[model samples]
Target: MSNDLFINLFVQITNMKQSFLAIVVMTSLVIVSCKKSATTNTNPQYKALTEAVYASGNIFPKNEYKLTANADGFLLKQIAFEGDIVSKNQMLFQLESATQDARLEAANNIFRQSEANFSDNSPILDELESQLRNARTKLANDSINYQRYKELYERNATTRIDYERAELAYQTSKNDVSARRKAWLRTKNQLYVDLQNSKSNFRVNAREDDNYRIKSFMDGKLYEVYKKQGELVRRGEAIALIGDANEVYAQLAIDESDFVKVKVGQEVLIKIDVYKDKVFKARVSKLYPKLNKADQTFRIDAEFTDEQPNAYYGMTIEANIIISQNPRVLTIPKNYLVGSDSVWIEENGDKKKIKIIKGVENLDMVEVKTGLTEKSVLVLGN
Candidate 1:
């Protein structure tokens, strides 16, 4: 072959090789660009994030109490019924206690009779006082005669037998006075003891009879009436239940796993079934230390900040106890997350998987603590 023809063939082969390399490089670039467009792209946003633990609870009155019957009897009258606003010590029911009333009346009559017996002019005291006055008069006269006899004996002007007789009369009068005073004091003391006994009996009988009237011990609305009129109630049986409606509290059941996260004074977002459209605010007021083994939950009592939802007892509620919060942080939409610790990103026109360090998360957003930057573009909703 000629030398020029050989050289032209070599040049043609070299150009074809260069063209093939160019086509391969363009195809690779096209494939990478298509992959980047196929995925949804978004930027990390700076926003607030909150972490919380879920809990369920019930609504109850602040101070609830049960009223029980103090005595056994037939319920003749029920003055207060369900939904009645009652005051402290208000009569709620009356039991049939005719026997108690009869006993009280007899006690009062006995008390009155004993009181009359111990009055200022009692018959026994009057008779004793009259004898005491007569004895005093006789003793005074004998004392004067004894003085006269003693003077006469000293001067030897009277017989010794007359003077001795005068002394004996004076001694007898003194003995009479002492006997009368003793008798009067004994009778008065006995009557005073009987009077006190009667008074005590009356007070005891009155107190026993007063137990028949069922009274409210607290001021609040009566929410339940367990017993009705004409119902036979025994001692200490529950007659009604009542509580104050102005203040309210929630009894929450928290999962045992979240026991350490929850604490007193933490903010709680409450939602009640009755008030579906509203969210109430409260704070944890108490924490029950023991776990309810049957349900694997612990009890938390929360109190409302301001006005509470107007609700009855046992109303169901859902609550979220906010454990932590971050006001300013870079985050990604929680739905864009592939798993707990990783997300896909569009880096240099290709889909690249990168791991992230997460801090706080909620249903809306997740906080990105590290491994990703503000300039990084994320492939969302893969």
Candidate 2:
């Protein structure tokens, strides 16, 4: 209740408040310091590291082809449909071939007629042969009679007029024989030509018939069907697409910077969207010389070294082209790398930056060729 006592009490309260605030500030500082010390550190270790160039691509059947119609007609039937596995020379389509069939029939009829005319017992040839035989017999008889008449006339045993008649008859018989032989030869040549022409016409019709039936040239699975029954298809119209089902390859595109590093026969790892958890092994089969203008990427084709898993055409694929590898080398998680050749290391409980000689690197790990050892600790952070 005294004035001196009240002043003393106020002084004690103000001092106590100041002391509590000071304690709170010091405790906050200690907590902040402890939180900062919680850093992740990893020691470099020996591991297998691989360097790869990223690429995107798709799976395609080997020797894929589009089937086109060779002749124009209404599609009468589809012998093979999409998803059907067909062999070489297998019929895939049948166009309406009524006109071709008629043509073939007419041609066959003409060929049969020509063949009959050219037969060994043909009437025209037979008549010509009979006339030639008769003429030859007459010529033989006239020649003998002419010889006797000439001898008799020379000896004056017969009149000169009789000998002249005999000679004339002999000459006439010779002319008749020659004329008959020429007629027979002409008939034979004409028949032979007619037969050849008929045979040629028949083949032309047969080829036209073939055009109406579309056949496959390679063994493959028909991936697409472009025409339906009763649809009018023009010549050279694509009717189907086909490719080998068991044989497949990946067509990929890599960045232009990696074009030089990717070579034929290098190993490739392919990951497809459909096969989410599986990784397939493939080898670089071909390298295209030209770059893709749209994406500014180089093209690569790879074949599966192992049996290709059953896959559809044009499936999305992500691939890594392994450029180089280091086995059992000192490596660190790539996340710890700060730059192309630098990493942050912890030395004496403090963060220190060091430049390193780097080798093969991949999506997850980096190979340290020099400037780091198992004793070096790496500070991994964002």
Write one digit per residue (lDDT tens) for candidate 1, span 202-309: 999988887999888878888899887888999999999899867779998877888888779997767777864466788999999999998888899999985698
Model 2 compared with the native: what TM-score? 0.80
lDDT of 2 at 355: 94
Instruction: Give me the displacement of residue 185 in model 1, in angstroms.
Output: 2.6
Best by TM-score: 2
| Reference-based TM-score of each model | 0.77, 0.80
Candidate 2: where are CA atoms >4 Å away? 1-42, 155-157, 344-353, 377-382
Q: lDDT scores for all predictions?
A: 0.78, 0.78
The regions of model 1 sitting more than 4 angstroms off are 1-43, 141-169, 335-339, 344-354, 377-382
Q: Residue 2 of model 1: what lDDT?
A: 30
